[model samples]
Target: MKTFFSLLQKKLFAENAPLVMLVGLCPLLIASKTLISGLVMAAAISSVLIFSCVVISLVRKLIPDNVRLVAYMIIIATLVSVAEIMIRAYLPTHYVNLGIYIPIIASAGIVFAQADNVASKNGIVVSVIDGTLTAITFSIVIITVSFLRELLGSGTILSHRMIEEEYGMSFALSGGGGLVILGMLAAVVKKINSIKKSKKEGE
Candidate 1:
Protein backbone atom coordinates (compact mmCIF):
# COMPACT_ATOMS: atom_id res chain seq x y z
CA MET A 1 0.00 0.00 0.00
CA LYS A 2 2.73 2.42 0.88
CA THR A 3 4.61 1.39 -2.24
CA PHE A 4 1.51 2.06 -4.32
CA PHE A 5 1.18 5.55 -2.89
CA SER A 6 4.85 6.23 -3.51
CA LEU A 7 4.63 5.16 -7.13
CA LEU A 8 1.46 7.19 -7.55
CA GLN A 9 3.12 10.33 -6.24
CA LYS A 10 6.11 9.74 -8.48
CA LYS A 11 4.00 9.27 -11.59
CA LEU A 12 1.44 12.01 -10.91
CA PHE A 13 3.29 15.02 -9.50
CA ALA A 14 6.95 14.25 -8.91
CA GLU A 15 7.61 12.73 -12.33
CA ASN A 16 4.53 13.99 -14.22
CA ALA A 17 3.17 12.61 -17.49
CA PRO A 18 3.74 15.14 -20.22
CA LEU A 19 6.31 17.24 -18.37
CA VAL A 20 8.58 14.57 -16.94
CA MET A 21 8.15 11.59 -19.21
CA LEU A 22 7.18 13.61 -22.30
CA VAL A 23 4.41 11.31 -23.37
CA GLY A 24 1.22 11.93 -25.34
CA LEU A 25 2.12 15.12 -27.16
CA CYS A 26 -0.53 14.84 -29.88
CA PRO A 27 -3.57 16.06 -27.92
CA LEU A 28 -1.30 18.04 -25.66
CA LEU A 29 -0.46 20.46 -28.47
CA ILE A 30 -3.46 20.35 -30.80
CA ALA A 31 -6.43 20.06 -28.44
CA SER A 32 -5.11 22.30 -25.70
CA LYS A 33 -6.24 25.66 -27.04
CA THR A 34 -8.90 25.79 -24.37
CA LEU A 35 -9.22 24.38 -20.87
CA ILE A 36 -12.36 22.47 -21.81
CA SER A 37 -10.59 20.89 -24.74
CA GLY A 38 -7.57 20.00 -22.63
CA LEU A 39 -9.67 18.52 -19.84
CA VAL A 40 -11.66 16.45 -22.28
CA MET A 41 -8.51 15.20 -23.90
CA ALA A 42 -7.11 14.34 -20.48
CA ALA A 43 -10.17 12.30 -19.58
CA ALA A 44 -9.90 10.34 -22.80
CA ILE A 45 -6.21 9.64 -22.35
CA SER A 46 -6.62 8.73 -18.69
CA SER A 47 -9.38 6.27 -19.51
CA VAL A 48 -7.24 4.64 -22.13
CA LEU A 49 -4.27 4.54 -19.80
CA ILE A 50 -6.11 2.97 -16.90
CA PHE A 51 -7.98 0.46 -19.02
CA SER A 52 -4.94 -0.52 -21.03
CA CYS A 53 -2.83 -0.90 -17.94
CA VAL A 54 -5.38 -3.17 -16.32
CA VAL A 55 -5.72 -5.30 -19.42
CA ILE A 56 -2.00 -5.54 -20.03
CA SER A 57 -1.20 -6.30 -16.44
CA LEU A 58 -3.76 -9.10 -16.26
CA VAL A 59 -2.47 -10.74 -19.45
CA ARG A 60 1.19 -10.11 -18.92
CA LYS A 61 1.94 -13.70 -18.08
CA LEU A 62 0.46 -14.98 -21.30
CA ILE A 63 2.30 -12.49 -23.49
CA PRO A 64 5.58 -13.65 -24.95
CA ASP A 65 8.46 -11.38 -24.02
CA ASN A 66 9.76 -10.84 -27.55
CA VAL A 67 6.35 -9.99 -28.99
CA ARG A 68 5.24 -7.80 -26.10
CA LEU A 69 5.45 -4.65 -28.19
CA VAL A 70 2.94 -5.98 -30.68
CA ALA A 71 0.72 -7.16 -27.87
CA TYR A 72 0.82 -3.78 -26.18
CA MET A 73 0.05 -1.87 -29.40
CA ILE A 74 -2.90 -4.08 -30.19
CA ILE A 75 -4.32 -3.50 -26.73
CA ILE A 76 -3.77 0.27 -26.85
CA ALA A 77 -5.24 0.62 -30.33
CA THR A 78 -8.35 -1.29 -29.30
CA LEU A 79 -8.84 0.91 -26.26
CA VAL A 80 -8.30 4.07 -28.26
CA SER A 81 -10.91 2.92 -30.76
CA VAL A 82 -13.36 2.44 -27.95
CA ALA A 83 -12.62 5.90 -26.63
CA GLU A 84 -13.03 7.42 -30.09
CA ILE A 85 -16.40 5.83 -30.64
CA MET A 86 -17.68 6.82 -27.21
CA ILE A 87 -16.49 10.39 -27.60
CA ARG A 88 -18.06 10.77 -31.03
CA ALA A 89 -21.35 9.50 -29.70
CA TYR A 90 -21.40 11.40 -26.41
CA LEU A 91 -19.58 14.64 -27.24
CA PRO A 92 -19.84 15.33 -30.91
CA THR A 93 -18.54 18.85 -30.62
CA HIS A 94 -15.44 17.83 -28.69
CA TYR A 95 -14.95 14.84 -30.93
CA VAL A 96 -14.97 16.99 -34.02
CA ASN A 97 -12.79 19.61 -32.37
CA LEU A 98 -10.30 16.89 -31.55
CA GLY A 99 -10.86 15.17 -34.91
CA ILE A 100 -8.21 12.63 -35.91
CA TYR A 101 -6.04 13.50 -32.98
CA ILE A 102 -8.04 11.34 -30.57
CA PRO A 103 -7.44 8.18 -32.52
CA ILE A 104 -3.77 8.95 -32.89
CA ILE A 105 -3.51 9.12 -29.14
CA ALA A 106 -2.98 5.38 -29.21
CA SER A 107 0.10 6.08 -31.22
CA ALA A 108 1.34 8.39 -28.54
CA GLY A 109 4.77 7.13 -27.42
CA ILE A 110 3.84 7.36 -23.76
CA VAL A 111 1.27 4.56 -23.74
CA PHE A 112 3.49 2.01 -25.40
CA ALA A 113 6.47 3.24 -23.47
CA GLN A 114 4.77 2.69 -20.14
CA ALA A 115 3.46 -0.70 -21.24
CA ASP A 116 6.91 -1.78 -22.30
CA ASN A 117 9.01 -0.24 -19.56
CA VAL A 118 6.88 -0.47 -16.41
CA ALA A 119 3.89 -2.76 -16.92
CA SER A 120 5.94 -5.54 -18.42
CA LYS A 121 8.25 -5.61 -15.47
CA ASN A 122 5.83 -4.97 -12.63
CA GLY A 123 2.79 -6.74 -11.18
CA ILE A 124 -0.80 -5.78 -11.94
CA VAL A 125 -1.32 -3.58 -8.91
CA VAL A 126 1.84 -1.54 -9.44
CA SER A 127 1.17 -1.23 -13.14
CA VAL A 128 -2.33 0.11 -12.55
CA ILE A 129 -1.12 2.71 -10.10
CA ASP A 130 1.69 3.78 -12.40
CA GLY A 131 -0.62 4.09 -15.36
CA THR A 132 -3.17 6.13 -13.43
CA LEU A 133 -0.53 8.42 -11.99
CA THR A 134 1.03 8.95 -15.38
CA ALA A 135 -2.32 9.74 -16.92
CA ILE A 136 -3.29 12.15 -14.15
CA THR A 137 0.04 13.92 -14.33
CA PHE A 138 -0.35 14.28 -18.07
CA SER A 139 -3.84 15.72 -17.62
CA ILE A 140 -2.67 18.29 -15.11
CA VAL A 141 0.14 19.65 -17.29
CA ILE A 142 -1.89 19.83 -20.48
CA ILE A 143 -4.81 21.40 -18.61
CA THR A 144 -2.55 23.99 -17.04
CA VAL A 145 -1.08 24.89 -20.40
CA SER A 146 -4.48 25.03 -22.05
CA PHE A 147 -5.87 27.23 -19.31
CA LEU A 148 -3.06 29.68 -19.77
CA ARG A 149 -3.44 29.71 -23.53
CA GLU A 150 -7.19 30.26 -23.40
CA LEU A 151 -6.93 33.09 -20.93
CA LEU A 152 -4.11 34.91 -22.69
CA GLY A 153 -5.07 34.12 -26.27
CA SER A 154 -8.80 34.83 -26.04
CA GLY A 155 -8.98 36.65 -22.72
CA THR A 156 -11.48 34.04 -21.62
CA ILE A 157 -11.54 31.39 -18.93
CA LEU A 158 -13.36 28.31 -20.19
CA SER A 159 -15.29 30.72 -22.42
CA HIS A 160 -16.41 32.78 -19.43
CA ARG A 161 -14.62 35.87 -20.78
CA MET A 162 -12.49 37.14 -17.93
CA ILE A 163 -10.19 39.82 -19.35
CA GLU A 164 -11.41 43.22 -20.40
CA GLU A 165 -11.81 43.63 -24.14
CA GLU A 166 -8.96 46.11 -24.32
CA TYR A 167 -6.51 43.68 -22.73
CA GLY A 168 -7.54 40.83 -24.96
CA MET A 169 -4.87 39.63 -27.33
CA SER A 170 -5.20 37.38 -30.35
CA PHE A 171 -2.10 35.20 -30.09
CA ALA A 172 -3.41 32.77 -27.49
CA LEU A 173 -5.05 30.27 -29.81
CA SER A 174 -2.59 30.82 -32.58
CA GLY A 175 0.47 28.66 -33.27
CA GLY A 176 2.32 30.87 -30.81
CA GLY A 177 0.37 29.33 -27.98
CA GLY A 178 1.55 25.89 -29.03
CA LEU A 179 5.13 27.06 -28.90
CA VAL A 180 4.56 28.55 -25.48
CA ILE A 181 3.18 25.26 -24.26
CA LEU A 182 6.25 23.49 -25.56
CA GLY A 183 8.44 25.97 -23.76
CA MET A 184 6.52 25.39 -20.57
CA LEU A 185 6.96 21.67 -21.03
CA ALA A 186 10.69 22.15 -21.33
CA ALA A 187 10.73 24.22 -18.19
CA VAL A 188 8.87 21.54 -16.32
CA VAL A 189 11.34 18.88 -17.44
CA LYS A 190 14.19 21.08 -16.25
CA LYS A 191 12.57 21.54 -12.87
CA ILE A 192 12.08 17.82 -12.46
CA ASN A 193 15.68 17.11 -13.35
CA SER A 194 16.79 19.74 -10.87
CA ILE A 195 14.77 18.14 -8.12
CA LYS A 196 16.15 14.73 -8.98
CA LYS A 197 19.65 16.14 -8.80
CA SER A 198 19.00 17.69 -5.40
CA LYS A 199 17.62 14.42 -4.11
CA LYS A 200 20.68 12.59 -5.35
CA GLU A 201 22.90 15.09 -3.58
CA GLY A 202 21.01 14.61 -0.34
CA GLU A 203 21.35 10.85 -0.64
Candidate 2:
Protein backbone atom coordinates (compact mmCIF):
# COMPACT_ATOMS: atom_id res chain seq x y z
CA MET A 1 0.00 0.00 0.00
CA LYS A 2 2.79 2.43 0.89
CA THR A 3 4.64 1.69 -2.33
CA PHE A 4 1.42 2.05 -4.31
CA PHE A 5 0.72 5.49 -2.90
CA SER A 6 4.31 6.56 -3.46
CA LEU A 7 4.20 5.54 -7.11
CA LEU A 8 0.81 7.20 -7.50
CA GLN A 9 2.20 10.46 -6.15
CA LYS A 10 5.12 10.30 -8.60
CA LYS A 11 2.82 9.60 -11.52
CA LEU A 12 0.44 12.42 -10.65
CA PHE A 13 2.95 15.22 -10.00
CA ALA A 14 6.53 14.24 -10.82
CA GLU A 15 5.73 12.86 -14.27
CA ASN A 16 3.21 15.21 -15.82
CA ALA A 17 1.91 13.78 -19.10
CA PRO A 18 2.13 16.92 -21.22
CA LEU A 19 4.90 18.87 -19.57
CA VAL A 20 7.22 16.08 -18.51
CA MET A 21 6.27 12.98 -20.48
CA LEU A 22 5.58 15.19 -23.54
CA VAL A 23 2.92 12.95 -25.02
CA GLY A 24 -0.45 14.11 -26.40
CA LEU A 25 0.88 17.29 -27.92
CA CYS A 26 -1.29 17.46 -31.02
CA PRO A 27 -4.55 18.00 -29.17
CA LEU A 28 -2.85 19.98 -26.44
CA LEU A 29 -1.43 22.47 -28.93
CA ILE A 30 -4.30 22.69 -31.39
CA ALA A 31 -7.62 21.86 -29.71
CA SER A 32 -6.60 23.69 -26.57
CA LYS A 33 -7.26 27.07 -28.20
CA THR A 34 -10.03 27.66 -25.72
CA LEU A 35 -10.80 26.61 -22.17
CA ILE A 36 -13.91 24.62 -23.13
CA SER A 37 -12.15 22.91 -26.00
CA GLY A 38 -9.32 21.89 -23.69
CA LEU A 39 -11.73 20.58 -21.07
CA VAL A 40 -13.60 18.55 -23.66
CA MET A 41 -10.37 17.09 -25.00
CA ALA A 42 -9.28 16.22 -21.49
CA ALA A 43 -12.60 14.52 -20.74
CA ALA A 44 -12.56 12.67 -24.02
CA ILE A 45 -9.02 11.36 -23.55
CA SER A 46 -9.58 10.58 -19.88
CA SER A 47 -12.59 8.39 -20.66
CA VAL A 48 -10.77 6.47 -23.38
CA LEU A 49 -7.62 6.03 -21.30
CA ILE A 50 -9.41 4.83 -18.18
CA PHE A 51 -11.86 2.42 -19.80
CA SER A 52 -9.33 0.99 -22.22
CA CYS A 53 -6.88 0.44 -19.40
CA VAL A 54 -9.52 -1.41 -17.40
CA VAL A 55 -10.52 -3.57 -20.34
CA ILE A 56 -6.98 -4.29 -21.42
CA SER A 57 -5.79 -5.08 -17.94
CA LEU A 58 -8.69 -7.44 -17.35
CA VAL A 59 -8.00 -9.32 -20.57
CA ARG A 60 -4.24 -9.14 -20.54
CA LYS A 61 -3.73 -12.82 -19.89
CA LEU A 62 -5.96 -13.79 -22.78
CA ILE A 63 -4.33 -11.58 -25.40
CA PRO A 64 -1.43 -12.72 -27.52
CA ASP A 65 1.74 -10.67 -27.49
CA ASN A 66 1.84 -10.38 -31.25
CA VAL A 67 -1.75 -9.14 -31.56
CA ARG A 68 -1.91 -6.92 -28.48
CA LEU A 69 -1.15 -3.75 -30.39
CA VAL A 70 -3.99 -4.37 -32.79
CA ALA A 71 -6.28 -5.19 -29.88
CA TYR A 72 -5.39 -2.02 -28.02
CA MET A 73 -5.96 0.12 -31.11
CA ILE A 74 -9.35 -1.44 -31.73
CA ILE A 75 -10.42 -0.90 -28.15
CA ILE A 76 -9.21 2.70 -28.06
CA ALA A 77 -10.81 3.54 -31.40
CA THR A 78 -14.11 2.09 -30.27
CA LEU A 79 -14.06 4.09 -27.06
CA VAL A 80 -13.19 7.27 -28.95
CA SER A 81 -16.08 6.71 -31.33
CA VAL A 82 -18.47 6.34 -28.43
CA ALA A 83 -17.12 9.50 -26.84
CA GLU A 84 -17.56 11.46 -30.08
CA ILE A 85 -21.18 10.40 -30.48
CA MET A 86 -22.11 11.22 -26.91
CA ILE A 87 -20.36 14.58 -26.98
CA ARG A 88 -22.00 15.50 -30.27
CA ALA A 89 -25.39 14.52 -28.88
CA TYR A 90 -25.07 16.21 -25.49
CA LEU A 91 -22.44 18.94 -25.85
CA PRO A 92 -22.82 19.98 -29.44
CA THR A 93 -20.74 23.11 -29.07
CA HIS A 94 -17.82 21.36 -27.46
CA TYR A 95 -18.14 18.51 -29.90
CA VAL A 96 -17.83 20.89 -32.82
CA ASN A 97 -15.07 22.84 -31.15
CA LEU A 98 -13.05 19.69 -30.50
CA GLY A 99 -13.61 18.72 -34.13
CA ILE A 100 -11.29 16.02 -35.48
CA TYR A 101 -9.16 16.02 -32.37
CA ILE A 102 -11.70 13.88 -30.56
CA PRO A 103 -11.34 11.16 -33.14
CA ILE A 104 -7.59 11.61 -33.24
CA ILE A 105 -7.37 10.75 -29.59
CA ALA A 106 -7.45 7.12 -30.66
CA SER A 107 -4.03 7.53 -32.24
CA ALA A 108 -2.69 9.91 -29.61
CA GLY A 109 -0.17 7.19 -28.55
CA ILE A 110 -0.42 8.25 -24.93
CA VAL A 111 -3.48 6.07 -24.34
CA PHE A 112 -2.23 3.06 -26.26
CA ALA A 113 1.24 3.38 -24.75
CA GLN A 114 0.01 3.31 -21.19
CA ALA A 115 -2.55 0.61 -21.84
CA ASP A 116 0.01 -1.52 -23.60
CA ASN A 117 2.93 -1.07 -21.26
CA VAL A 118 1.41 -0.69 -17.80
CA ALA A 119 -2.05 -2.16 -18.17
CA SER A 120 -0.84 -5.24 -20.00
CA LYS A 121 1.57 -6.03 -17.19
CA ASN A 122 -0.31 -4.86 -14.10
CA GLY A 123 -3.41 -5.88 -12.18
CA ILE A 124 -6.75 -4.19 -12.75
CA VAL A 125 -6.51 -2.00 -9.67
CA VAL A 126 -3.03 -0.79 -10.50
CA SER A 127 -4.04 -0.11 -14.09
CA VAL A 128 -7.06 1.87 -13.00
CA ILE A 129 -5.06 3.97 -10.59
CA ASP A 130 -2.39 4.61 -13.22
CA GLY A 131 -4.96 5.54 -15.84
CA THR A 132 -6.85 7.86 -13.49
CA LEU A 133 -3.72 9.65 -12.31
CA THR A 134 -2.32 9.99 -15.82
CA ALA A 135 -5.58 11.43 -17.04
CA ILE A 136 -5.66 13.84 -14.13
CA THR A 137 -2.11 15.03 -14.75
CA PHE A 138 -2.80 15.45 -18.45
CA SER A 139 -5.97 17.36 -17.68
CA ILE A 140 -4.20 19.70 -15.29
CA VAL A 141 -1.53 20.74 -17.82
CA ILE A 142 -3.85 21.04 -20.81
CA ILE A 143 -6.49 22.94 -18.84
CA THR A 144 -3.93 25.35 -17.44
CA VAL A 145 -2.47 26.04 -20.89
CA SER A 146 -5.96 26.57 -22.30
CA PHE A 147 -6.93 28.90 -19.50
CA LEU A 148 -3.81 30.96 -19.98
CA ARG A 149 -4.17 31.02 -23.78
CA GLU A 150 -7.83 32.06 -23.73
CA LEU A 151 -7.15 34.70 -21.13
CA LEU A 152 -4.18 36.16 -22.98
CA GLY A 153 -5.40 35.71 -26.54
CA SER A 154 -8.96 36.89 -26.14
CA GLY A 155 -8.74 38.64 -22.79
CA THR A 156 -11.56 36.48 -21.49
CA ILE A 157 -12.09 33.75 -18.99
CA LEU A 158 -14.30 31.05 -20.42
CA SER A 159 -15.46 33.49 -23.11
CA HIS A 160 -16.48 36.12 -20.61
CA ARG A 161 -14.69 39.36 -21.32
CA MET A 162 -12.20 40.02 -18.56
CA ILE A 163 -10.15 42.43 -20.65
CA GLU A 164 -10.74 44.31 -23.84
CA GLU A 165 -9.79 42.31 -26.95
CA GLU A 166 -7.67 45.22 -28.11
CA TYR A 167 -5.50 44.76 -25.05
CA GLY A 168 -5.31 40.99 -25.25
CA MET A 169 -2.33 39.39 -26.93
CA SER A 170 -3.85 37.95 -30.06
CA PHE A 171 -0.65 36.04 -30.74
CA ALA A 172 -1.50 33.74 -27.88
CA LEU A 173 -4.18 32.20 -30.07
CA SER A 174 -1.69 30.97 -32.65
CA GLY A 175 0.35 27.75 -32.68
CA GLY A 176 3.54 29.65 -32.11
CA GLY A 177 1.94 31.17 -29.06
CA GLY A 178 1.01 27.76 -27.76
CA LEU A 179 4.59 26.63 -28.18
CA VAL A 180 5.80 29.61 -26.21
CA ILE A 181 3.44 28.81 -23.37
CA LEU A 182 4.42 25.14 -23.50
CA GLY A 183 8.08 26.02 -23.33
CA MET A 184 7.56 28.24 -20.30
CA LEU A 185 5.55 25.55 -18.60
CA ALA A 186 8.23 22.96 -19.35
CA ALA A 187 10.80 25.25 -17.79
CA VAL A 188 8.69 25.65 -14.68
CA VAL A 189 8.25 21.90 -14.35
CA LYS A 190 11.99 21.38 -14.79
CA LYS A 191 12.74 23.92 -12.11
CA ILE A 192 10.35 22.27 -9.70
CA ASN A 193 11.94 18.90 -10.35
CA SER A 194 15.36 20.34 -9.68
CA ILE A 195 14.15 21.80 -6.40
CA LYS A 196 12.70 18.46 -5.39
CA LYS A 197 15.95 16.73 -6.31
CA SER A 198 17.93 19.14 -4.19
CA LYS A 199 15.62 18.59 -1.23
CA LYS A 200 15.91 14.83 -1.57
CA GLU A 201 19.67 15.04 -1.75
CA GLY A 202 19.80 17.23 1.32
CA GLU A 203 17.62 14.84 3.29
Best by TM-score: 2
Error of model 1, residue 165, in angstroms: 4.0
Task: Write down the TM-score for model 2.
Answer: 0.94
Model 2 shows how many backbone clashes? 0
RMSD of each: 2.4, 1.7
Give Cα-based local distance difference scores for all models.
0.83, 0.87
Q: How many residue pairs clash in each candidate?
A: 1, 0
Candidate 2, after superposition: displacement of residue 9 in Å? 3.8
**What lDDT, from 0 to 1, does candidate 1 have?**
0.83
What are the per-residue Cα lDDT tens digits for candidate 1 across 1-203? 89867776666656666666666776788888889989988899889988888898889999988998888999999999999999999999998888899998888987888888878888888888788878877887788888888888778888897988678667767767677667776786678768987998999
Off by over 4 Å in 1: 1-9, 12-14, 192-196, 199-203
Candidate that scores best on lDDT? 2
Q: How accurate is candidate 2 locally (lDDT)?
A: 0.87
